[model samples]
Target: MSRWRRLWSVPLLVLTLCVAGCAITVPSDPQGTLDRARGGELRAGASASGELVTVDGSDVGGSLAGIVEEFADSIDAKVVWTVGSEEDLVDGLEGGDLDLAIGGMTDATPWSQSVGVTRGYAGVPGARGPVVVLLPMGENAWQAAIEAYLDREVTR
Candidate 1:
């Protein structure tokens, strides 16, 4: 083989090995729940309009809000709602004003990976219901809680 080809092959083989060795193994239940008392309070933020209202009189647009509420209830945690634009809510979480936030806008954004969202729940209408869950970065406990909650609800 040519010297150039041989050199390229070595790097390619090393890259492939690294990728294979580093592959992440996801849990069977992607949404794993933590104990509520142990889980602590979960502060969630969301964008709202006058047209959308929660059971508590908080403004939360779309059916996504209802699902959020249900999940929060199931988890036995209070959802601290921050009603405003998507940017406002995201800013609130980033600024340490909130623990978690959920919105449709976020589901399509670059931040989705950090937020940890699940799309297209049944009976939500449209192509799929938009639901995004924004969790604190590096908070593995919260991630597990949210993931477990989602797996339970989505399965139902």
Candidate 2:
């Protein structure tokens, strides 16, 4: 190739490579949980945990509940809550029956093996330590959405 042609091709190739590298890719969700819940119901499991999570019959409420509700609303989804024990909530998460779980779970939760936990946020009312929300395992996009919401709304 001619020297001029070779020099122009090299710069074009570098520019192409840089643009490709800088392109944004959506995070993956192995189960398509985020995609499904975007305009539909967000299945959420809740356990009774003091002021962090409260259960009254079929109704779920509390500080964490409010956050979950807001998160759902942000996605144009509604929360369909299932109130249960922690073990049941974990099972729900593992089985993909639930998109996320909340029950005043802390950073030190023992169910980390079966589900994904959000980053702990301190300053939660009535929480003894940093509070976390449980999510379906390997759902990166869903987890990222929730984490971003929490990061914006929750107090450090």
Estimate candidate 1's alpha-carbon lDDT, on a 0 to 1 scale.
0.56
Candidate 2 segments exceeding 4 Å error: 1-26
- Candidate 1 structure, TM-score to reference: 0.55
Q: All candidates' lDDT scores?
A: 0.56, 0.91
Model 2, span 1-156: residue lDDT tens: 999998899899999998897754667898999999999999999999999898999999988898899999999999999989999999999998999999878999999988999999886677788999999998999999999998898876
Per-candidate TM-scores read 0.55, 0.84
Deviation in Å, model 1, residue 116 alpha carbon: 5.2
Off by over 4 Å in 1: 1-41, 49-57, 113-130
TM for candidate 2 is: 0.84
Largest TM-score belongs to which candidate? 2
